[model samples]
Target chain A: MATSVEQPQTLIYVLGVTVIFLASALIGIMYLAQIDISQEYTLYNIQYSSTVSRMVNSPTCFALEESFELPEGYGTETQVQAGIIDWWKFNSGITKVCSDGRIIYAYLSSLDGTLQKQLLTGRDPLTALSDSDLESIDNWNTKQEKYYVLVYKDSQLIPAILEVRIKG
Target chain B: MKKAGGAFLTELLLATVLVLIIAAGFFGIQHIPGFSLEPEAKALIQSVGDNEICNVNLLNLIRSPNEDGTLGDTLITSYLTKDYTVFNETTTNILNQVMLRRWVMNLSINNRVEATFGDPAGFVAVPCIAYVPLPQPFFSNCSFSEIQTGFDGYEINFTTPDGNVTMEIVNQFVTDSDKIGGFGVYPTSEWTTIPETAIIGEPTTINDTLNADLLILQIYVGDESEEVLIPYELTISEPSEDPDGLTEVHLTKKDLVQQCSIALNLFVELNNE
Candidate 1:
């Protein structure tokens, strides 16, 4: 009779342990799901935003800059204007100076569909690799396209779109 | 006692195995593609995309090139010509390449909507707004002047004795005669006549000289009515060339406040990621 009673008590203890384990596991999964969701896009977005900012604001990129003669013994000074694309510089591949060892392709097109320019900067690792190699990595890349960039051409401010594709 | 102990150990092992199997299944379901956190991830992406478009993209689209002129220029031209093909196509083409979201663009002139692109029923949201002033239209030779003068030596003949009498004659668009003829010239092409009312008296018949460049206002002084004729000459000359470079009316900022402006709105819908 004592053994039978002890058996039922041990069974209750096992049931209690299983319930606690399942509850804890569910909570752990919920916490991990939140982190996974945020981690997926946050890093990509940060990199994308940074690349776009540098491309538009940096003089070595497509930014418009003007040179003015300085007075006295001072040398001429250059002023870089943000949010303006120098049409001549853009067409002349001056943007090649913007290559900073990363794979990026910047495309610009006038809203009127009359003008388009594409520049590829950085190393072309994928070009050298075989198709099978790319497929192995799942062909990972992030693309961001923005509108309302002003292209300064012939004393006119032309509206345009700039698309940047970053390859990982 | 040994038998009971053995059964207890077996039952504990079985319970442990059952819990492990359930946990494994739960984890497998979570790892399935798009099964966990898809809605949250989608919402975040959509929010970022929309914010960029509102802050940066719409501004550029208005300033971007459309054809022989900027996109804003094309919009104005399209507004007047009723041919929105160029503006609509240029904008849609640029946006289509980058975005999959459905959108609608509304162009309002002087607070009144003049052109709309995209289906009205497709999307609903507060639009991204941008304003572009219409290019000022140039008129070579156009003049407007109003000369208020009193009737001098002109006949003041009113047949009414008592009560009130009023007469008004408005001339629109100065004709050749009004331009070549001297001060009393009236427009013959477009003339607006006000019906005269002579209360408590017969219909007033005034002389042609009284009708020339004159507006008669008869006021009642006690029982007796006194007639007064005021002379005013308004001269409006049509432009020698096209009046408004874009349209027929002379372009003025005051007139344009309600009729001619390029106000653009872009309403975007969230696309499934």
Candidate 2:
């Protein structure tokens, strides 16, 4: 009879311990999963910003070139201004003029959403990212939009933005 | 049965120990810092938050030509003239267009917030702040005077960037239970009453709205009164289109470039929703 009583007590103890252990394991797994997700998102943000900065500041990209009359009738001097997009240059595939090895897929649009032009740099992602792949929830990707000054034709400067989406 | 029970207890103990070891190892790995993003990655993230984007946006905006084919001098003109209409319109329109997230932009002159454009509410998370260095505005517009109301006490009057402010000593306590004497703030057009509580040695604060941005006076009515630092606001008003003779209404390029040195702060928050 004493043995039987001790067996139930030990069983209860073991049951309680198992419950607590399982609960802790579940919580730990959830917490670690959260940390992983956050870290990935942070990395994606860093990558997106890096790519956008490269495109915006690089003269070979969409940066607008300004012309000014030099002193003493030195004709005219033209130089690239960072963060200013030239519409003509963008249309002429300026990115293709010089390959930077890095992949970029973006769209430039007017602030009022009037005009939108697709920008692609590098390859593979074009073939890798299918319509179904984009819709998949598990697909890792980051998208960000940044503002820029769009120089239309050779005169008008309109406010514009670039939206970049990256998948890796 | 006794032997079986003992075996069960031993197995439970072993399981507990194994679980603890695994948990400890997992947690230990997390603290090692090897599983994080690289330093360059972190810096890039920080720049993305504020610096890189803000600098690019602000510079482009400043360089953009206005309606009259003049370089964007909105920030300078607004600070000098104190007419935020054009500045607000330009910044608001562009910011709304460019920003894909919620943000607040504050134009500060001498560390004083002159103009704020955004709803600074609800989103209380950490903001990515971008600070753009500005030329120091000439603080040539400050005046001060003291008027003796009675023998024991007097009133101090001063002008700041915001407006005029007047502070007077309170000779009598508001209530018998009041510990320390406070100031009666007559803020030019408004009357401000002081709090009736005090901590024996500390100076009493006189809160007024006249120059809320720049002036806050704390008067200690004790033996050998304490001298407080008086901060003056910038007052050299440049030219604008205002008909009021109080400010110079004509803004010149030279004045805008040389005189106006108002710093800009862009606080951006990614809209998680």
lDDT for residue B48 in candidate 1, whole number 0-100: 60
True contacts kept of each: 0.27, 0.30
Off by over 4 Å in 1: A1-35, A57-60, A66-84, A91-101, A109-117, A123-140, A144-161, B1-38, B53-56, B66-68, B80-86, B97-100, B109-115, B119-127, B134-261, B269-272
Instruction: Label model 1 with its docking quality class.
Output: incorrect
Evaluate every candidate with DockQ and list the scores: 0.15, 0.14
Off by over 4 Å in 2: A1-43, A67-79, A94-99, A112-114, A121-140, B1-50, B68-71, B122-260, B270-273
Clashing residue pairs for model 2: B135-B261, B239-B248, B239-B249, B239-B250, B240-B249, B240-B250
Among the candidates, what TM-score does chain A have in each? 0.62, 0.56
True contacts kept of 2: 0.30
Q: How far is candidate 2 from the true structure (C-alpha RMSD, Å)?
A: 17.6
Output the lDDT of residue A65, model 2.
69
lDDT of 2 by residue, B4-64 (tens): 6776777677767776776777666557754543443444455454456666776676666
Model 1 CA lDDT for position A23 = 66
TM-score of each: 0.45, 0.48
> Model 2 chain B, poorest ten-residue lDDT window?
B245-254
TM-score of chain A of 1: 0.62
